[model samples]
Target chain A: MPHLTLEYTANLGLDADAALLALNHALAGSGLFEEADIKSRAVPLHSFRSGTAATPRAFAHARLALMPGRDAASKRHLADALLAALSAQVSSPGLETQLCVELQEIEADCYAKEYRHG
Target chain B: MPHLTLEYTANLGLDADAALLALNHALAGSGLFEEADIKSRAVPLHSFRSGTAATPRAFAHARLALMPGRDAASKRHLADALLAALSAQVSSPGLETQLCVELQEIEADCYAKEYRHG
Candidate 1:
């Protein structure tokens, strides 16, 4: 019952690989996820500029599918940890000048491709 | 713990108001939601033409945040109901042609704006 999707705006300077690695590290060994269940995708957004005063940046949306036993507390912990890891990439941190994080839960039958094949 | 999001490509003929009303009607008396907590935004996408053979159509992505008491079964029912309502707008439906439905879990403190104020 735990599937997390994160939508956030990160600075242009942050390396995608580094950010992804950091996300993986934060999610690793949480005892709440299976080995291959975690799925993620990086979208380099340069066109639709809604937030951050129309700056040309990328919004990386990551989706993590975990095992179905975590409660709200554990989900919040993982989501917060993921955001903290992501925002740490910035040289300076402030409430007004940090990346945004929105997390969501995913259902087991939500993935059509996975469900149809396996 | 019910947060449902539906992202799908509808034909150019579908009216936004009708679609939104259909959504609202489906979730009106679900008994799983707090009235004012349901938030939605209808984006008429015309530029991003990735699916449907590059047709100039809109992709409506709706987000529904419900109370923290509904379980997976209830959540799935709500999500399926929402999609059925959405897809019903189309005159014809087929397996190869339909909008997408993605459901996620929402923690109590996931909404930053809501959490900071109340």
Candidate 2:
């Protein structure tokens, strides 16, 4: 029940190669995690801006299958650390940033490889 | 904890308008569900077959935020029904298909509307 997925507007000054590298580093620096069970993906959100549609927004989505035994205290601590790492890496004060973290608590039987023929 | 995300190769016969309509209808026929919390998305996967890499595969991804109160028995019943509906809609017996369902169990503090700037 500790899997987490993070979805945010893309291209928000956070997609640059340099910024992404820094973010990955921050994630690795956190000793509470391992990438063995974590998988993250960044999806692009683009739309047209005509007249009164306000400014455009970008988002990124990260899906993480957290390791087992993550308690309430540990989750909060990890979340705060992640946000801090992201903030330090992004460094864009003018853009409106949004971070949404969802902790997936339940899981059923899932196979790493497709058992179609078997 | 019943949120389910289904991902498969795209461009299968199920992508046809008629097939999708039938699938949605079948989902609605199940009295244990509501569209308010169920959200599904389909992404296409296409690649060229130039050598002995075998035939092409199509997949679909459905993300369903299931309504609460789905117990073990209820989930099994629902999964069977959903699979039956999909099979009935996609009648291509020759096509190799795969069905993977995951139950999302845990959720943390999540706001439908971003509480940014507040």
Candidate 3:
């Protein structure tokens, strides 16, 4: 399973849900994962600090959690696509924005889940 | 830098900020990374879907963005501790809750950032 978390700063003029949708679409288009298999969400970062800059700072970083199996090139392509999608959707006029994408390998054996219904 | 993002369902009876603080404290206590170096945040999920259950379902999932270097045992220990910390913090009486922790490796070479002031 691949879970995508897109974190965009509040200062950045970007719609989180819209960006998630677009990025998810782009990822699905990569022919790696099915559209339905991808679970995506947006995290709007409110409180943050960064290096000194003349203008205000903002960022939109996407982290994708992937179960172990994909090769290096496949992941690289996916990450690059996500970054391009973020830059396209999150660019503002005056804010200093940093865009990033990271791929996380989830150890399939160690992963655990249980429903505690109480 | 290791960035921690904790995502808890809206129905979960948890204080987002307090849980973040406690979890960050727990991570720092591990001696793996300094408290100040851990950039932490919480995302309250308003919408989700899960399997059929008699009671309402809720979850608290933590994803840590870690740069590659730590061994398997070290990462496993960190994830287990984080899961325990989450369980201790976010528990409600009636809802079925699932707690999970995921460690993601951020590739050093592929990571890119640009501060754009425009």
- Report lDDT per candidate: 0.51, 0.44, 0.77
Interface RMSD of candidate 1? 10.0
Model 2 Cα lDDT, one tens digit per residue, A3-58: 44443333455644544454455456666656443344544333211111133322
| C-alpha lDDT (0 to 100) for residue A88 of candidate 3 | 79
Model 3 is docked with a DockQ of 0.18
Candidate 3: stretches off by over 4 Å: A1-6, A11-43, A46-59, A63-99, A103-118, B34-36, B114-118
Candidate of highest DockQ: 3
> Looking at the true structure's interface, with contacts defined as alpha carbon pairs within 8 Å between chains A and B, what fraction does model 1 recover?
0.07
The DockQ values of the predictions, listed in order, are 0.07, 0.09, 0.18
RMSD of 1: 9.5
Candidate 2, superposed: residue stretches over 4 Å from native:
A1-39, A44-62, A77-100, A104-118, B1-4, B16-34, B47-69, B91-93, B99-104, B107-118
User: Tens digit of lDDT per residue, candidate 3, span A1-118?
Assistant: 6798887777878877789889989889999897777989987787453322234656677878888888888888888888888887885778655677888788899887654666
**What tens digits encode model 2's per-residue C-alpha lDDT throughout B4-52?**
3334454456543343344445455565644322222333345523246
At residue A108, what lDDT does model 2 achieve? 46
> Which whole-number lDDT from 0 to 100 does residue A58 have in model 2?
26
RMSD of each: 9.5, 8.9, 7.7
> 2 or 3, which is superior by TM-score?
3
Q: What is the interface RMSD of each candidate, in Å?
A: 10.0, 9.3, 5.5
Give model 3's TM-score versus the native structure: 0.58
